[model samples]
Target: MSKHAGVVLPNKFDYGYHAEFQRQCSMCIDDATIEGIVFDFSRVEYLDSAALGMMLMWQRRAAAANKKMMIKGAKGATAQILAMANMQRIFEYI
Candidate 1:
């Protein structure tokens, strides 16, 4: 079975979510059964460059673990921001 994790992003994907984000990323990375992770951005309302940096970190971690990474439900400003950061080139959109 192909195991995957969907990490639901919070409303304010800022520095405040650092701990939680790290925990989530670690959870996924530590799980050897998890073959991929999809960052769900449907509920995110506000985000900053910090959030972008976090995403990059997650991507790197996932790569190092030999796992796939993806984005889901990124709309409005969230979508625009990801596009501006060229996240599409790194993460698959689901």
Candidate 2:
């Protein structure tokens, strides 16, 4: 994850990435100049429940920091999964 570009999630956005994601978002909260985060799902083939939880965590953290969060490239099953989780209402899909 680049400090200025935000995180471009891995192809498998799963539990394995949780710890790192948390760390990155934590940094975002601390950096006053960081304006927002874009969670890129373009390469993600499978997004499991744990991934959803991670996103939710980031959402809360971003909100606390007064930053916006955007989800991009959610296709096919990935789109359905986010929809099922009702993440659309809380997050904007780009």
- TM-score, cand. 2 vs. native: 0.87
Name the runs in model 2 displaced over 4 angstroms. Answer: 1-4
lDDT of 2 by residue, 14-94 (tens): 999988888887877788877777777888889899999888987897898788888888888888999999989988776
Expressed as tens digits, the lDDT of each residue in 16-60 for candidate 1 is: 999999999999999999999989999998889999999899899
Give the Cα lDDT of each candidate. 0.93, 0.82
* CA lDDT, candidate 1, residue 53: 94
Residue 31 lDDT in model 2?
A: 85
Clashes of each: 0, 0
My TM-score estimates for the predictions, one after another, are 0.96, 0.87
Which residue pairs collide, candidate 2?
none
